[model samples]
Structures are given as structure tokens and as C-alpha cells.
Target: MAGDLYPDHGVTGTENRQYNREQRAGKHEADAALYKSHQCEQTPHPGSWRRHDQRTQGPLVAGYGIYTQGQEILLTFSFCSSLVSGYVITYFPLRGRSETIRLILSDQGAKWTEEEVQFTDWFTANCEHKKQAVFGQLPKFKDGDFVLYQSNSILRYLGRKYGIAGGSNQESALIDMVNDGVEDLRMKLVRVLFYEPEKGTEKYEADLPDQFSAFERILSQNSNGTRFVVGDQISYADYNLLDILHVHLALFPACLASFPLLTAFSDRISSRPKLMEYLKSEARKNRPIVPKK
Candidate 1:
């Protein structure tokens, strides 16, 4: 569905309605207290703190936090969205391609709001949003006044903006490679899901071992199959790979049987404290991967 000419969906409703002014003030105060307690080296911004240096070793890579002796003290500070309230994702009610972006935001503890568009409205002749989109497609992303289209482009933009793209230029290149690889596989899956469910699914299942081996090898090549995909720290590519793997698991329950590293990697990424909470919540569970046409 996503690779089609039109792409997915979006809405023009209120931006990040879940967060109110009072909630913002309360969170800002809490962040200040956390900053004071940590004895941070940098000054606090209006709503949040700056990101920790990538060289610092800890559990978190993007968020503001300091590493103690063998312990990670993550500070819930997102400088990118601090000045403003938070990011707003305008897409269809389904998870679709937007889920990866949502996972990165939630894992980083960044505040974001969803602007949902109903299917009835999306296909209607009088759909104003269709006329407004740059490419006449959905899954549009808005960061303050800057609006971005194309799901992968949005992911890359956020990855760079939030410091989760990669640690170095080389790692960034590797990350991009991994993301493109995932996109290729995802497009194949999309063809099966949206275009030819009967014949394509059978072939996709038959080629599962060959298709998944690359990801498995990637895990083994990096840190002896222990940490994330590309680097020691988590990158946006990890989020993309994990999301696609998750969808594959749903389609074929035994998909990862031959890939031990991938299974463990999925388990580790899914166990992240903040991401775990979001994964188990109704907001994620209730949304279908592909719409019921």
C-alpha cells in the first residue's frame, strides 16, 4: 500500500493534543530538578536539556543522560522538541510506515501527537488534505513549521535531528545502508500484503531463510552479535529493522527459527523500558498493521 503512487495517509487536526500547557510546565519543572540532581555540565533550556555526547557510554544514545559506574541514568530531556511542545505525526489510524518513527520517538522519550485521518475522508472527492500534500501522499511529518513527506525521508530527518542517525560518518553510512536494505525487504512485504496476498505470500514465506540471513549476519558482524545492528549505540536503522522483523513474525510465526541472533536482538530491543511500555499499550496494540480493505 505504501509504495503505491498515493502512499499512506495523514490529517490536519490539532497538533499533539495530548500535551497541554500545564503539563508542559510540570514536565519542565521536573526536568530542571533532574538536571540539578545530575549536576549536568550544560545549562537547562526552557523545557528540556541537551543531548549527551555520543562518545559517552550508557544505555541511551540520543536522550540527555550521564553514565555512572556501570549504570545508566537517562535524563528525559529532548532538546529538539523542548522549545516547542513536541512533534506531531499526521497519518492514517494504522501503524504502517509511521510505526518506526513512532518507535524512535517513544524510545527516546520524546513527546509526540498523532493526527489521524479516517479512510472515508481520505478517499472522498472533497478531501482537502490530498490537494495540500506536496506529493499528494500521506504519512506527512511536521516538526514545528517544517513539514516533511515520504516516510523514510521523515525517518532520516528525525534520525539526524535527534542524534540517533549514527555515531560517526562511517557508521552513518552503514546505518543508511541497513535502512535501505530494510526498505527493500519491506517493499517486497508490502507487495504481498497489499497487492498479491495469495501467491506472493507463499513465495515470500518460501524465501524467508534467504531474506532474513542478511539481518542475522549484520548482527553477527557488529559487536559479536551482542549489541545493536550497526554500532554499540542504538540507531534509527535498528528501529526500522526491528519493526519489519516484528511484522514478519506476525505473518510467519517460525520466521526467525533459523536466526538466533535476530531473535535475541528482537527480544533485547523490545525489552527497552520506555519502548516496552508503548508496545504493550492500547495505542500500539489496537492499531492494525494494514487496513482491512
Candidate 2:
């Protein structure tokens, strides 16, 4: 359906309305504390003091707390509306980590009030003077007074806060293993497709068969006819792997033609009403490509 010149359904208005309604409800809930603080006209929470004290006493990533006081942490990326938010929230899955955290506050939603700054602009404006701030970095979270780098660590912190890391240590380790594997493969693919187009595309085409084969093996082994990636319910592993697979298909449509199973899986996942709506909104908005080259 997606490969067709025009999507048959064409992302209906009803779908947009539904998404907006859910989004507004979520935003009000997420901003309740912020709103209440404003109405009270009070200083920041007492926890801010504790947070500052901890950062002062504890090890700082560079010289600042991972999150500064009173700053809404901005998760920086090239395509702010794309799958980056999906990856972060699914992995982190904490309270106050719904669409509002990933989408609304990040200036991608219809009702966002914050000035939407490009990731590059925001980084240059804030982190340029800090020697510890790294260049060519992304998925960085910036709060009012502090900045935190490292996507995986951010994900871990979010997951721990949300209680989605795993019920047991073994499960958590498995989640990490699966996530790392997917991320590793994704990075490799991105390098080839975007970083060094000619060389990378050549390498990608050459390795396409092996890559599909590996995923086929994984699906055959892990999936027992269920639609999800792991366990009985959907987990972060499923979402991350699906996103990785989706990227591959979007970049190289022919790649999907060879692997029927993967193609079928991709189709099935993409056909989901929610995911379809999300993707269509992205396409309509002309979100930048992942690598943004």
C-alpha cells in the first residue's frame, strides 16, 4: 500500500482528528505539573534543590548535571518528527513519557508552544562554548540547565523510570542484547545508504542477501507464528526491530521484494492503523531522512 504512487486511503481526516484528540488529551496530562506550578506562581520544586545537590556531589558528565534545573529536556535529532521519538519512548517507556514527551514538547505537534529550533541550531546555540560538548552528536537530551548525551543511556534511564526494562535481570539483559543487535545492524545499514552513497549502496546491495537471511533466521527462531518480536506482548525489541526493518524497506524497496517473509512482516506492521497514520503524517510533513545528508 505504501509503495503505491498514492496511498489508497490517503490518510483520512477522521484519522487526523483522532490523532489530534489523543494528542491534546495527552498534552494536558503531561503539562499538568507545569501548569499547576505556573498557576501557583511558585519557584521550582524542592526536588530541584535535591537534584542540584546530587549533581554537585556526584560525577558530572562534563561539568554539569545531566539535566539542568527548570529546563525542559530537549531530545535533539535531525528529523524531530520521525522514528527517533518512537525508539526513545518504547525503550524508555516511563511515566510522562508518552506522545507529549516525544512529540508535543519537541515542536512536532499541532499545539506545541516552544520555539522549534533545528537540532543543529540548538546545539550551536547552547553547547558551542562547552568544551566537553561533543560535535556530530545527536539524540542528546537538554533540560533547562543541563544536557545529557548518549542515546542508549537516555533510553536506559527512561526505561528504568517507566519500569519497562524487564521484570528480571535476565530479561533486561536479553532486551539489551536484542536492542544492541538491531542498533548495530541499523547503524551499519545507515552508514552504507547515507554516509557513503556510492560505496555504501554497493556494499549494501552486496550484503543484502546475507542481511535478510540473518533476519529470516531470527524471525523463524523467535517468532512462533505470533505477530510480535518477543514474548506474548509487544516489547521495545519488537518496535525497534520493526523500525529498523521499515527503514531498510523505505530506502531500498527492492530489498523487500527478495525476502517474502520480511516483506510480508513489514507490510503487516505498516498496515496497522496507528502506525500507518503516524507514517502518513510524517510523509505529509516532509520530515527529513534519518541521516539528513
Best by lDDT: 1
Q: How does each model score on lDDT?
A: 0.75, 0.45
lDDT of 2 by residue, 194-243 (tens): 57767647667678788668666555655543454444443455456666
Q: Which candidate tops TM-score?
A: 1
> Model 1 clash pairs?
none
Q: Candidate 1: which stretches are off by over 4 Å?
A: 1-84, 198-200
Worst 10 residues of 1 by lDDT: 2-11
Give all TM-scores, in the order shown: 0.74, 0.51
- Please, what's the RMSD in Å of model 2? 17.7
- lDDT, candidate 1, equals 0.75
Q: In candidate 1, how many clashes are counted?
A: 0
- What candidate 2 gets wrong by more than 4 Å, as runs, is 1-136, 142-147, 161-164, 198-200, 271-273, 282-285, 290-293
lDDT of 1 by residue, 187-291 (tens): 998988889876757778999899899989999999988999888889899999999999999879999998999999999999999899999999999889889
